[model samples]
Target: MKKALALVIAVLMVLSIVACASPASSNTASNSDSGTPANNAPAAATSSDSENITLHFTWWGGDARNAATYEAINAYMAKHPNITIIGEPVSWDSYYEKMLTQLSGGTAADIIQADYKWASDIVLQGMPFLNMKDGPIDYSAWAEMPAEYAGNKDYVMGLATGINVKALWYNKEFFEKFNLTPSDDWSWKTILEAGEAVNKADPNSHLLWANSDNLNAFMQSYILQLTGKHMIDTENYKITCSVEELTEYFNYVKALFDTGTLPPIEDLVVYEGLAYASQVPEWLNGQWGMCMTYASNTLQVLNDSTFEIGTMLYPVMEGATDTGISMMPTQLLCVNKASPYQKEALDFVEWFLKDEEAITISGLQRGIPANTEAAKLLEQNGVTNAIINESIAVAAKHAGSAEGPFDTNAELNAAALDYIYQVAYGVLTPEKAASQTIDAMNAILATLK
Candidate 1:
């Protein structure tokens, strides 16, 4: 695959050249509408005004993640004394819907651990968030900001703290029982063959682990592996795959569903990995063999299994001209463009990204740290978060240390996911499904453009 170096360099120049504005200029009277006072509302009438900086921060994750993040926030507050960081955590299911209301109503939090899928839509649409480039925030620290973002001044919304690498995480015991080795050199065809072997070994067990909800991202990884192109192109507001290619991908997935090698779509939807791990289900009970997922969720999958769970890059295609490349881009922290605490927010973000205290709390649960110094601290502490370590290593090797594909708006992702469900459930043939998806997506992309 050709390097996107020229694209990357051009983005960096644009971010560096945007105009700077005052914190007051950025904040509007609408701040009060979000249930928070403006940044300069006379510093409060209280005598302890020095200890009154309240920053509301929001993120989406499971309970373990919430606890770790709150601990980090508490530690920061304990030292700062003068600052109070409000923690607003939500589950992934409802997070984006609630946040879209907040962003639209001008009630967005001071700091948002943003999804990359939503960054382009939110920032470029002027959804009332602070532009990092228009302030003193340093783009130099973020190595993963894609060329499109780096080069565009108006869309500079957030700083990425971590990145995720897609891979096939499997149980060692299952492979041992089948007398099979999880081959690093295996292609997608080989993976299907392995799945067939596992299916034959236990008719009740599935060889591949998945829910109906995740088929699109799985397809994205698979498509990128085959074409070296993104599912959605931010620049053109388009999907690049031909109709035939998309039909082939969806048909393959549908075949897996129909063959009993993967769970039925209806049964899988209620069994998200975060909610189902540790129950010793067919997968953890040593029934299912391999699962497609990210490093961040490996702990959830392996938390209860007695078998040694290992992670490997997404299986490539045999004799293919291109290597399988996992999509890489974890969420990031973005300031409300209307935020009054622009400088202070930047200061807090800078510390959060670069501070040792923050790194100790994060431990790459959300993603691999983008901060070099903070990553080094995690390394030196000799923590055994092997999944994170492995994810970082794989991302560096195959993902080129650049920002991954992004959606114009976060909602469009839901639409894309819906298309996956429609196709998977046999509501439409792969050809018709792909055509419907492209048509639906192109309509949404038009709104973004």
Candidate 2:
């Protein structure tokens, strides 16, 4: 368990070093620039699928995802008798570290899955990836091309696999037992009240099972909604929020900790690095009624729960200018520019997104499909999850400003995350935490540009 946090911290340290290195455009050495080995490498010009070759694809998810992905991979391989595609599935906690190691060593999977923001960081680090538009993917299938790549016309970082929004998942049984409703009108205050009620009735349980990552994201939403601006204005390379606003955000966070809506700091510290509800046992054992996770993760987050689960919009703030919830891509799928088998890899990627069989098998495992036709097919087959679809509606109905690239800078995020942790633990007051966080973020932002 300790290794989890340590490994996570190590990745952040590595990123900080990467960020401080020579400007990416001038960096000589890059993980993506590593040359492919002759023996197993695919011929650069070969576009035919007739050749017998093995390819590897990597992604991170829970048991449901693994099963669906494995099934899909098998289906693909079975269709192309000569091509063997290996599925490299990793747990969420260990994914980035492993992905980074592979990328640094020039051993990254032919098809690389990355968070959209991380994909930007990868490019900024001088890592090369294929301009997916030059490949076999059908652009017309997409209803809305992820605008993330709009400004960087030369690069389509990855073919987006799905679209998701940040939201909370509630256990129906627990909510019913406590006479609570996870309704569309629910607000931050409503959740706190519900949590207090749950704890009063059963001290052994808490209102939610949220870790550092989840809580940090919640803080981001609050800041965005309250100020109508993000903490960092990446385009200008500046810290955008005032300390007064941050103090308000922290005070709300403190209220959550104080009301027992979330467990004590000690209880969640060990699970700090965990990114999903399915990762912790508290959600599974019914010790918590709700957990915040990305909409894409609904199926996986509820994998083993015996209780029926429901989805709700991320709680809103009254009279807010923005919804504070933005629809984000699920994962960016890019072909390794260094891959010997770029042609074949692109073929598989195209098939995964455009093929009905692939889309149906994958289902809502990755949330709502980005491909218009794929979404239609899933609807035709009734393979879509109702709650997951509802989550998408909620996100659209209350969409806010899109998060910018620098808005989620790895180093700056780590700094603020540390402060949030301190505030939760009670040793740091909200004012001090907000002041220190602003100073720390400004110092990091100053290094930008």
Candidate 3:
């Protein structure tokens, strides 16, 4: 009987040891199922569809833009758990230089924020940004002008984020205090007369704040108005207008200076290299009543003012061939052809441009939304500013055909500015300045061909 009882005890002890060993094996299987660890679990888990892709999106803007973009990116990532986006925001001054270097070295971000003018230059030079025509991005909701930019095959650029046109920004209080209303006609003669009247009323104030950059833009519009030709004929690889035509354009600018409708060259010089209206003394003090600026920049200008601000039609040259208002894409988004995540990059762009939530977050900081539905959405939500709405409407009604890619040619613009400064300083007759400008521009254009 003792021998039999000892045998039972030994059997029970073995059973207990077996049960303990079972849990160790089961725990390993449980860890594997829960994606915790099984000693050799893959370094990173990935969805079958996404493979855990990551993309880099780069752009240049101020603090507001950076913050808004980051928020939008975060929202996108929340909805797309398998994807990650890295944001690279830089200042406008160093943006192009750094991008160019990265592009050449094959290390550029997968998604690029391209200047409209730079799109053609980069794509046509054999850089391979993905062609959206082959992609899933729905651009049917964009306005005609911005749509045109996206549809071009040689450029094959991404959707425009904003539509920008040069607008006349004015201080409403200054106009009212002088009993001045902007001319309904928006003709050069009428605008100058209005400016002269305002300057006469308040010796401390000037009719307009003119800087070389803005003045150059005005000159381009005036030339377009007169000649019905783009300043540079990219197709022909030459300047479209003659020296005589440019002289006439410069003479008008000179008249603006001589009559005190514009500030002296010396006064304007201090504001060079500054990008915002808020930074200019004349704008801050309300001494300058009006200026030429992009629709995209109107908010910043308005924010710094103590009085209500208004927008006017871009001035027209009397009996001119064009309205002198060019509506162009503010900037574009492009996908690198070499990027491993091309489809994902395009997906983000589609969401960024057309997504209602993203548009609300973006507002008009980048100018009017290029997506028609997005713009309407802002209006429906009562978030669209009245000034921005008016500017968009005015630009749409009066805008001319978009400028050619070469219109914003860096070398040509630099040469034009130099010649303009010479005319403003009385160092050269308008004729001489015009002649020199044409020659220099044609020389540069020839090399480009």
| Top candidate by lDDT | 2
Tell me how far candidate 1 lies from the true structure as C-alpha RMSD in angstroms.
Answer: 13.9
lDDT of 2 at 373: 84
Q: Which regions in candidate 2 have their CA more than 4 angstroms from the true location?
A: 1-44, 47-50, 133-136, 149-154
**lDDT for residue 371 in candidate 1, whole number 0-100:** 59
Tens-place lDDT digits, model 3, residues 100-201? 776665667878898776655665566446666634577877766733354354345667888777778888888888787764367778767877777677
Give candidate 1 misplaced runs (Cα > 4 Å). Answer: 1-51, 139-154, 231-238, 272-280, 304-306, 319-327, 400-419
- The parts of candidate 3 lying over 4 Å away from their true place are 1-50, 146-153
Per-residue lDDT of 16-133 in model 1, one digit per residue for the tens?
A: 6653321232234446435444322312222243746677788887677788889888888888788778898977776777887776765677788776666555645544455555
Candidate 2, after superposition: displacement of residue 177 in Å? Answer: 2.3
Clash counts per candidate, in order, are 6, 0, 0
Error of 3 at 397 (Å): 2.0
Ranking by lDDT: 2, 3, 1
Q: Name the candidate, 2 or 3, with the larger lDDT value.
A: 2
Could you list the CA RMSD of all candidates, in the order they appear? Answer: 13.9, 9.8, 13.9
Compared with the true structure, what per-residue lDDT tens digits does model 2 show for residues 1-449? 99999999999999999898743321123324545433223336543657686778889877788899999999999998988888888766667778777666676788877777675566576545676654456667675644653215556767888877878888899888888866888888888888888888988889888876666677777887888787678677777888899999889888888888888888878887777776678878888889888888777666667789898888888877887677777887877776767778888888888898899898887778888788889898888787778888888888877766665567877898899888988889999999999899888878866
Q: What is the lDDT, from 0 to 100, of the residue 412 in candidate 2? A: 74
